[model samples]
Target: MAHFTLKQLKYFVCVVESQSIAEASRQLHISQPSISVAIKGLEDVFNQQLLVRHHAQGVSISANGRRVYERAKELLRLSNELEQDSREEDELVAGTISIGCFESAAPLYMPRLVAGFKRLCPGVSIQLHDGEQHELMHGLHRGRFDLAFLYDLELESTIVKEALNAPHKPYALLPADHHLARQPFVTLAQLAREPMILLDAVPSKSYFVDIFTQAGLSPTIAYSSPSIEMVRCMVGQGLGFSVLVTRPRTSVTYDGQQLVQLDILDDMPDSALIMAYLRNNQPTRATRLFMDYCRTVELAAVTPLAASA
Candidate 1:
């Protein structure tokens, strides 16, 4: 029988995932020698050369190492579940949950959600990361995040999603003084003729472009940005109009410029915000509680965004 501790497996997994003992050491806040010893101990127990170490370049997992790494991840997940179950038996939930959120939606939703969840489960801590859709999805697959909050856009078959809110129609953003600012509603055909400031983030850029293509129109993208606020600031400066679903409470930009929101007259697909997790990865007790909290909470009501147009 192989006698090894979970700590050894954890260290080994971290080194494999990070691809460097030094990098894993930094992440785990342990010394490089200590991590190396843990890896060596695991290798000795299994009698397998699980890693191919390179001088200063990092390390690569051997074929056998790859298989072991997968099993290690599963074991760690199961161990976490078992620990959570034991903690729950005491009627006190305590653990940390890592969450990934869409960058644009994070500012609007995460603050309130995190605060409320923490109040309910004071024993549980949260670590949140916000990025683009691809980044968030990558985090989910890599096991960096237990779950993610993002739009239900081109998700993989392995991802299971729960809708957090009804689909929201996208609105056009324009400078307050623009010609079409006073219009109660606008059409894609009209906006198609004007310069467009595209939100260039992955999935978002493609989604907006698809919307125009579906309408048999192509926007003249005069400028593009990955940051939502930067896109809004450009619109406020009369650079170009933008299409967006996440609306802030105020019509002003960071530079004190005012913007206008107009409903799109054309029938377009609505966007749905969702909480997604991997189908294979079971949620810990704390993660399950947070997921439940998300389902019951009125996220839109707590956000500072204006009512949908």
Candidate 2:
């Protein structure tokens, strides 16, 4: 049996990411021949080909290579976490904590989270990455993110999630003086007839549509956008109304038209926000501290609606 080093695994993952041994070598400041030797050593140890080489065109990962790549990333992360967690409690909490957040939630909460956690643990630093739910989950699994803030929707079995204190329910966004603006809450059936400005982000789009479907109502979608501001702008223009989970602190849209928010009275599915990490990995000390900080902070109070610029 061939013995593989952590260095080999690291080199292998870089090769897969960079798509070629030459690129990985350049990025890592290692020689191309050295990376090739490491890769050959890995292939020998695994008894399977990890990459397919082409003379002019770059290499491609084999199916098994993809699996190994994911596991290798996880192993590297676990190793790093172990080193961080092993530090003395009295020692300063110092290290970079990589976080992935849902795009919709990032604008609302990242600054507060970073600032608050840094305040409590001055030695710690935070790195933030924003993506849709699926993208965030993928990064978490790939070990690109140490932790993530995501919605409790369409999550994979391997993703372990801790729900935040508040469960965000669907709410209506309408032009300030619309006929239904006086109502405290509007039902799906009530809004079914109105043109809808759909927030077209993944899982969000499906989840919102399901709420209408469950209510035996179908909304007439007038516009769709991945951007929350676009949806808000559409609503402000009176082109349609939108259903949103995160209410911006600002009641005004980008165009400066005032908008109104109404609760959804119908029994609709609410999306719970969560702090997620890979199921099998152990949390580092810094990760634990940040998670603790996040748990104590209430998102609503920290992230009030702001004037849309």
Candidate 3:
């Protein structure tokens, strides 16, 4: 016989999810004492501290509690699946999946992916949120996102990453008429002489700076923008050139100024675009289906002006 009942597991999971016993009790429509007893019973069964409670603040789940919570979620999922199987075995795939997308990639791929997924599975709906690398990973742990579309840069160990087919190689963004834009491939040393518009987003900023450092050159940064479009716009207006990984389909900025993409003659590292989710957590049916769909989708390659010639 199992030492703990589903009620105990539910209460414990709720406490971890809601981050407070009072909140869990209110959410579950159970009395505080009942929820507290259930939590204590779980700790007694496991013989480990499940939660570290704060007097005035909320509680934090211990390492052991996180493990238990993961397994409990799986158990609850299976149990729910079994119940659903009995009720509607032939039901169509349908659920709301929350996805966290990297801000830079969102504009490039999200619209197409969302539209295609909806067409393929009209029963399913996708809720998309865009954030930086760290924010996306944080949302994954907090159960706010089922999956995240992010680069392989600076990933957490707790995240299980599946690399997509997208190839994200850093390329130079220059005005269509820039003298260097005519070159088949430009080196960092050549571009370093010109003013640079840095993409000043967290990991992106560091990643771009490292490329110059590796090339034994430093750029004269004229401007920095958190917005990728802003960086592109600044470069398009001939303010300066910038290095970016994501290549939008069009080389034109929002203002219709044409920009040019050129391969870096100097060796530069490539970052893989990946789909990441919690390491041990089982994906929902909708999330699993979406992952499958993403694998077959072909990502657009970076288009260089020289290549088109």
* Top-lDDT structure, candidate number: 1
State the lDDT of candidate 1 residue by residue for 232-308, as single tens digits.
99998999999998877788799988888888999988788899999989789999999998888775532333322
Comparing 1 and 2 on TM-score, the stronger one: 1
What is the full ranking by TM-score, best candidate first? Answer: 1, 2, 3
Candidate 3 residue-wise lDDT, 227-292, digit = tens: 999999999899999998888878778887888888898878888899988986667777888899
Better of 1 and 2 by lDDT: 1
lDDT of 2 by residue, 1-309 (tens): 569988999899888876888889986799999999999999999999999999988899999999889889877777766666666565766777889988887888888889888888888878888989888887776666889998999888897789887548888988887888778778888899999999999889999888898878888998899999999988988898899998788788788887888888788777998999988876688998899888998776333353233
TM-score of 1: 0.92
lDDT of each: 0.88, 0.84, 0.85
Write the candidate numbers in order of decreasing lDDT.
Answer: 1, 3, 2
Q: Which stretch of 10 consecutive residues in model 1 shows the poorest summed lDDT?
A: 300-309
Clashing pairs in 3: none
Query: What TM-score do all the candidates reach, one by one?
Result: 0.92, 0.82, 0.74
lDDT of model number 3: 0.85
Query: What's the distance in Å from true for residue 289, model 3?
Result: 1.1
**lDDT of model number 1:** 0.88
